[model samples]
Target: MPVSRTERLLNLLIALLNTRYGLGRGDLREKVYHDTSGNDVAFGRMFERDKNDLRRMGFEVETLTDTGWAEDDSTTTRYRIGKDSNRLPEVQFGPEEWTVLLLASQLWERAALGTAARSAVRKLQSSGSLAAVELPAGVQPRIKPAGQAFDDLVAAMHARHPVAFTYLAGSTGREELRTIEPWGLGSRFGQWYLMGYDRARQAPRHFRLSRFTSAVTTLDKDTYTPPPGFNIREELDTLPELPLRTAVVRVRKGRLLALRRRAADGKGVPPAPAEETDDGGYDTLGLPFRDPEVLAEEIASYGPDAVAVAPGELVAAVRRRLRAAAEFSASPKPRYEFPGAGAGARSTGKGTSEDQLQRMLQLVPFLVHNQGLRIEEVASHFGISRRQLESDLHILICSGLPGGYPDDLLDIQWEDGRVYISQDLDLTRPVRFTVEEASALLTGVETLRGLPGVAGGGALEAVALKLSAAAGEEGRRAAALSGPPVTPVTPAAADMHGTVRDAIAGGRQLRLTYLSPQRDSLTVRDVDPVRLYSQDDVWYFEAYCHLVQGTRNFRLDRVQELEPNGREVSATVPAAGGSPDRLFTPNNGDTTVTVQLTRQGRGLAEDYYAERVAELPDGGMVVDIRFGNTAWLPMFVAQHGGTARILAPDELGDAARHWIADALAKYDG
Candidate 1:
């Protein structure tokens, strides 16, 4: 059986740690890496690689040289890890601090951040310095960006490698091959962007990861050095501001409330001359937008609720796009080809490189202070496998100050499982946080501050203080300038969240009176709560429902009553699968409901049901959609008024008619 890299490294570490005297190359090959024992050169190379890996992970391998000490009177060299330098100091965290860290870890419970957070939590748990605390429910803020481009770009940026990808240009709507030296990665307005030096353009440019038409492939490492004093945050800050244009639009009364609130909150340009329509059902308002095309798309998405009154070009653009969509749906053959079909290639780089780099920077100082620790203890402290630890150490041993001199390099030693750093190039302290990192932390803390459990707590305040201190003057100023405020949780919902979270943690079942929005009725359920998550401001409890005999997501706000049952949850629940988009996906055995939508309802088909559109010759659209449950279909049709009507499934049409009639009866009453 072939031994895996991780297994071999683990075996090597175990052998070294168990032995009092470090084993020589011959002994190591025979005792640990027996697979390579036949080839002396291969064994030597593997041993060297393993030693470098250990050094990279901040392990100090001490070498003992003795001549005439052996029976053969030959100079023999023995290796051992210095137990003094490899251990991390025992650090105590206060309850508030622990809570803050816990909240921080929870905030990053999805993407790349989640991986680091898990490792950190593991390390903390293994140390037994801080007791584990239950995190608050409805406080998890996960950032899961689509595609592997972001991950690959981040790796290239860290490794100083050039990356090549096919990017769909926003200006031309054309796919073009781009080779760039990735300098930094950042997120703005929930979109990830890669800032890099475009090789073709010979200029710095920013590429939105979503626009990538192909997988990112990392080229040679150290392709080009970043210019001195190249600060990604500063570059982002210096980006030119987009010019805003005023747009006059008419919106339906009580509709577009979110937009009005955003404008009121000073998040966008103020609207002026907002006049009520004669029918008392519409309002005319002037809104400002940076991109007329983007604004047009937004207005189009609102269906008949919003319409562009002025700016003929914007109006024409929206109409043109809608007409094109309608025409495309009507065609049996392909009228237009999609731009990003080449995105099927696998991404070359891994996501964990950036996180590893950050950890390595912190590791230097940790090893410098602690000095001597056992290999296993060091690996556990860092929450890494022995192989990974060795790989990291290897990288560190070859890394040093800019001079590249022997004395300038890091002097790391590991012998007989113990490790130490004998000579350090003054790399004892961690590098200062970049602007993006500080901003991200501030954003995370601000988000956590709105959660019921974290709000009004000293933990957030303490965390904020530390973040501000680390951010320095510029970062502090950036953080001080607040973005949008977090949506506050309802008191009832907050209480339910606590109840469900506790039940899930304690392995107890829950009794809940849940208000079914679709059925417009209340139903009591016995649930074995599994996971608690939140999207935007809405909290959901993913539970194994005893009533349904399957997992279901219960909206916390819709839960009328929640009580923890004394019975322990005995049945094991399967893990939650699929993306966030899965919530909107129809079940396999769902009924296909067809609907004919008028031109005014074109936006609905264009935006929400893009995959279901079949165009009619008269500028209307027929949408064939699958619904897991048709309970909410009536209300959805009624909301669109006469613009949409069910064409198939007579039962659905009858239900929609009944819903409209019920509403009319209420008005009559």
Candidate 2:
């Protein structure tokens, strides 16, 4: 039988790696490609593609053009895979550095970075340089989740590909198509920003993640490499802050409380009776803002309860948004990527041959270092099933040097139930960093520098330095990845993160000073922590609230104080009914409200977890959204300004109309 492509590639890798003088094209054709290719043109094409594939996999394939095979022709290039250049240079890490590195790797719990961080950590572990004890109590931290756009940008950047997206510019408040050569992505002040050379503008520009109106897409792979010695941070710093502007607003009493919290100096036009509202009273306040569009969205969410009193531009913005919202007719809506949608979806697929080959390359060195590990343990480490592991192992057993001999092929056996690699075929060390792997670790480590109360910060810096040196170009791609403040990394809420995580791990109860948005009040409560997770970049922890005597999800941002209450488990609440994936699920008590949503309001279906959604021909959506507390429905309707309308339960629509009438009344006066 003709040699399998995988075997041929392996033979090529072994031949190139073991060579000292660099193998010429003629030699590779004769030794590695003997059974695979006969035609000279075909062999040359295969050799070139394979060489490029090796480079993409992070191997340093050096070419010497001057040294040809026959003394007659000096132009034929000789290729050699330099072991020293491809492999990670030896490094010593104290336990503390390893702990910090572990924490850094844990930053991206979901999306692209999460996979990257995990794989990166495994590679580092294979190096035998990771000597880490479990992080001490009160030391664990978590990363805020990134959106789909963030994930796509990191992927495109690592692949050295250009990307295109529909971006809603903050300045113009207009959605436009933008194609860019992405350089770096990072957070400046609790918001994610992408720094890239805009192809349309032919200049470097920074775009925010929230402003992404559509999905990010990659253009062509290897479109153009970043300029040499480019730094992601240096590029990010060039983005200037948005100019500060303020808007004065009149708010009806007991309404628009969140807006009240952002008031300037707590002293404004003061309380006054209003003829425009059904409300008996109103408060006039001055609100400071940066972007008009953002402010308009916020004000519109209040419906007519809050109105712009001054600044003709601010008034115009609010009027325009409300008009657009009102004018938006219901059409079809795109689906949302809800958390944990499919059941047992992760275990079904066996990967392609190319994917398996890549994993085996990493698996060899890992097995070599971590000997006698259970088959299940190995499968878990590589994120595969036992059957797939067996398949890979059997294939590995058949792989070796070009020659077919007992000694030439690898010696691997699992019949005894404990895997042992008698021979690794010189694949005893992890292969060099794939761009994705290097970028993940680099981005995670950089995010560590921003985390508050993290010990061994210098160790993190040192780890980043080593990764950058080893990863080279891949490291720069990682530097381009950034995110908002993970939870409360500031001084005050720093320790609370570890405390919550520690409580969950140690099974201890917690005391919290949490601000509830619905109740519009702060309360001290004791609770048994269940789990911690994030969505849309916000952190939340499910805990059994003692004050309410029920399980509740608390927003980490609104948490003022959190500490262990010195109480043990009450055993009243089970962790789960088979440990479900989502933190919260819709209960029977939630009321279904039918709403007409325009294209701008489609996000609401996802936010509220619509029970059912039907697309409208006009690019709008009719969704049956669930809400436990319909009291906030009016505000929800108002926030979309007018893009959302209550189609059923006539009472909610009346409430929203009244709220808007009250706010619009301010401008009338």
Query: How high is the CA lDDT of each candidate model?
Result: 0.58, 0.68
Give the Å error, residue 493, model 1. Answer: 15
User: After aligning candidate 2 to the native by TM-score, how far in Å is the CA of 88 from where it should be?
Assistant: 1.8
Model 1 misplaced stretches (Cα beyond 4 Å): 1-5, 16-23, 44-88, 129-137, 168-176, 201-203, 220-241, 245-669
In the range 1-669, model 2's lDDT, one tens digit per residue, is 676676677778877887787878777776777734457677667777888777766677887766336533524768788777777655556776777677666665555566667777777777563475555333334454434466667778877789998987756767899999988778765557888889999988888775666667789744877776667777667667665665777777776545666573334334322324434466777777666656776777676567776566677667765554444322233453222433222221123445556778878888888778889988987777888799788778877665657887888877567888888877877766776777667766666565544565477778777777877656655655654445454455446666777787777999988767667677999998876655424567788888888778887868878888798757896653222323356667888787877654554554455656666655556777777779877667666665587776778766766665555555554
List candidate 2 stretches off by more than 4 Å: 1-12, 18-48, 62-80, 136-146, 166-179, 199-202, 238-240, 247-288, 292-354, 450-453, 476-508, 518-524, 530-542, 547-551, 560-566, 569-669
lDDT of 1: 0.58
Model 1 over residues 1-669: C-alpha lDDT tens digits? 665464455445434544467766666666566654377667668788887666544456666667546533213777666544544334455676676666655454333434544444433333344454545432354444333465456556644689998876767756799999877665544345677789999998887664564567789644877665455555656655555566777776766764554344433564455565736466777777665555655665454556666676666544544443333323343222212334321111133443565566566666776667787877876756788788778767765433347875668888988779876654454444443344445555655656655534476777666556544642453332122223335677777877876776677889988876444467899988776766545677778888878667788867767898788875576533321322333447778877676544554542233345555555556666676677766656644444566766878877665655533332233
In terms of lDDT, the poorest run of 10 residues in model 2 is 341-350
Backbone clashes in model 1: 38
Model 2, TM vs. native: 0.72
